[model samples]
Target: MLKSNFARFAAVGLAAAALVSLGATAANAAPVPTEGPLYVYDGNGILIPTAGHVFDWNDNISASLSATDMAAPFHCSADATDSYTFLAPQGQELTRSAWQAYAPNGFTAEGSKDLLAFTLSPYQQTNGTQGVAKVNGGKWSLGLACTKDNGVNYASSGVWWLPVTVEAGTGKFTADPVGDPVVGSPATIDLEATTVPVAPDVDGPLSLNVPVGAKATLGAAALVNGLSTSTGKLGEFTVTDERALSKKGWTLTSSVADFVNGTNTIDKKQLGIKPIVVSGTAVAAAAQVAGSATGSAPFAELAPLAAVGTTKLNADLTFVAPKDSVVGTYTSKLTLTLASK
Candidate 1:
């Protein structure tokens, strides 16, 4: 019985060993790969590169006209033939005739194709004060159709930037002094003149019987931003003592306590109420009465800096009549010039 048991154990051991050997052989076996051959062409579509990248069309083209193709710049005829060359790779299995065969599917603008063309229309474009000529027509895309070794049809395409220009429109150049309150489209400020009556009675030792005074106000600068330059300036206020009855003397001054930019409020003690000494004049030869005072004052400095809005300047003129002097009409010309800096 013991012998019979040993034989049965040995047979079981052999069966187990066979199963382990089979598993080992399976793990050691090499895997087989399945892959197809890769085929490539000389070029995506057209083998030769086109000449000329950017084209600048001259005045010959008109904005009013529209057509399938343009002349000269593009080098392509209006008929679309002979303008561009269409050639296939030589000595290759694929010929221009077999081009469609490779691509069983048809060619489309977006799809694979043997040939393609695109165009853009002319439109208006503006850059600041500058005007750009109508773009007219531009080629957006150019592509050629080709066939692969397989049954699939493909297209090699390219995009180009074709900028054509026409005669540029003219631009305007202007310089103006705009006040806090804008007057016109380009902007204007008013520096009006007014006359003030003085008390006849003398107040103190240095006082006189009466004095006829004229007031001139300064407006905002259109182009002058409180800076002085050749093209423009902040502003200037000139007074020409054209004809004054009194020969004794006259005084010119400002009401601005502190000439500052961007100040909204006109200070009672500063703006229209301050005292400024006015001296200097380019008196006219004919109007130069003996012992008469005439001069031009520049208000450009009173203009605020970098202030894009309006500003104000008040100029006061006083005529110091000689005691017991002639009493005729006293007149003067007040000129205010607001310039750009």
Candidate 2:
């Protein structure tokens, strides 16, 4: 009976040891540690949850037809202000600092604000969109903000639909006289805009006709002529012949005279005057003629009497011709004077 009792006690001790080992193994097989719930605060110190914090939006972004001109209108104006609205998910607000607007490569924003205004309406749990606004012109981009826990800001930006209704007006340029006249003569023409912009599109191209009032003037004409005397006389004589003539009158004025006479008494008349006799006898008698009259006459004939006179005439003349008169032929009417006794 004592041996049986010892065996029973040993068996009971073994069972207790097995139970302790099983409990230790079970404790070692426990699952890995996990992170706790997320809690974040915004710049405004607003508490935001982690799991259900999602941003939902409904946008009615629109573009309208604007003004058109010489160039295409890419800008939006008050007349063609685009209207649109967006709704944020419940319990979410648009980050004011994160809002941004963009335009096409060449287009630009003109207004100061990207969003007109953000309002909290009476609609419970409803996010209100902003009012109508204008873009300078061209392609555009819209960006919104989402900050759930404020740890790191979230951003969403994209290009909205392009506004195709607006267009640029065509332009044309013209002058009064297409061709040039005289170099100095000016042709007159009116420069006008076929279509003026009553309501200008800030983005649309403006058409302007820059009228160029220009003219090509002609240079003064030149003339050359050969001058000669009617008489065969060779000795230098005044150039009395008037040749240089212009619309403004004659420029050159002077008379030339040449004469030759023999020693024998010669009778001649000029300008219908009485004949005047140049007596060689009287001249020879006065000079003491020792040789025959014929011989003396020959010696006297060697030298003849000569006289010349020149007078300058006025250049100023009154006629239909003017200094800057048109280019054309002109003629002068005048009288010549002579002395005879």
Candidate 3:
């Protein structure tokens, strides 16, 4: 349900925009219900109101649209194509993006494909306010053949109105005060080691890196009550993409060898990991498959880090041993592969 901030506008004078309903069907002009299968979010990641929202600026790269592929009653089929065409207030079509894969129910992101960026520049909002134009983030065609299953499909145009208010964002931000610190005579100062060293000026290209000899600690392994599960942390690494704008996107994948100690061996599948993006926006981490535990999940190649620049990456390590296995020191090698797209 729409919690608050819902300001309804009469569908009163839309004659110039061609005659049609405000919703999916011509007879119904109301917005989709909160429980609707299709949901659209604004550039700030907030659910767009039924009547849509007002923006202070255009060129929003954070906007995304997602629709659920229903099952059972409203089987909208799997992997249906979703197309969105933003329309002008005068009913002229703006831009359109047609993606083939519709998300499964409750799926926020698939693999490294999470957010969809959008923009609406040259909108020209003046005099405090502008249009209440129709911007259909997307429309679901929900193959009607499956409606025989007695379930209704989200076959709406899923259109949202975008009105611009330029006056709301006229204020400029002030900088915070900064000054030198004055230490009291009684203050104690300890000299800590620093890693800042002089380096030659060089603009390197794409690179996968970690500080030299920077190894992570995965605490000692021990068996307790015949069930021994050791969890560890992977060292951090940096991925940099100084490539041209055309070659910006990249993917990161990992694979581990079997943990072995002479005659003892632990399957690589028994050792799972939890991938994490320490820093970087638009860098998603659904590349991990965690079922019961944090590190006990399958990791797929995902695209988050190195979106256009650098990213810090890490993963949680877990080793689940089989019952009656011999106890001994074991070791494994983890390999991370990076590729440009």
lDDT of each: 0.22, 0.19, 0.40
For candidate 1, the clash count comes to 20
Q: What CA RMSD would candidate 2 show?
A: 39.5
Residue by residue across 220-277, what tens digits does model 2's lDDT show?
Answer: 3333122110111111112121111211111121121111123222111110111111
**lDDT tens digits, residues 169-250, model 3?**
3311111111211122122345678663222353237678977866665677676555677777887788876643344466
lDDT, candidate 3, equals: 0.40
**Span of ten consecutive residues with least summed lDDT in model 1:** 5-14
- Per-candidate Cα RMSD to the true structure, in Å, reads 30.9, 39.5, 25.5
Listed in order, each prediction's TM-score against the native is: 0.16, 0.11, 0.36
lDDT of 1 by residue, 1-341 (tens): 11110000000000111101111221111111111111111122211111111222221111101122222121111122111111111221112231111112223333223222322222211111112222222111111222222312111211121211222332111111111211111323456798632334431111111124544433332222332111111132343321222212223322122222343322122111122224333211222111233333333332222212122223333223333333333323333343322
Best by TM-score: 3
- Name the runs in model 3 displaced over 4 angstroms: 1-204, 222-226, 282-284, 287-307
* Candidate with best lDDT: 3
Give the number of colliding residue pairs in candidate 2. Answer: 21
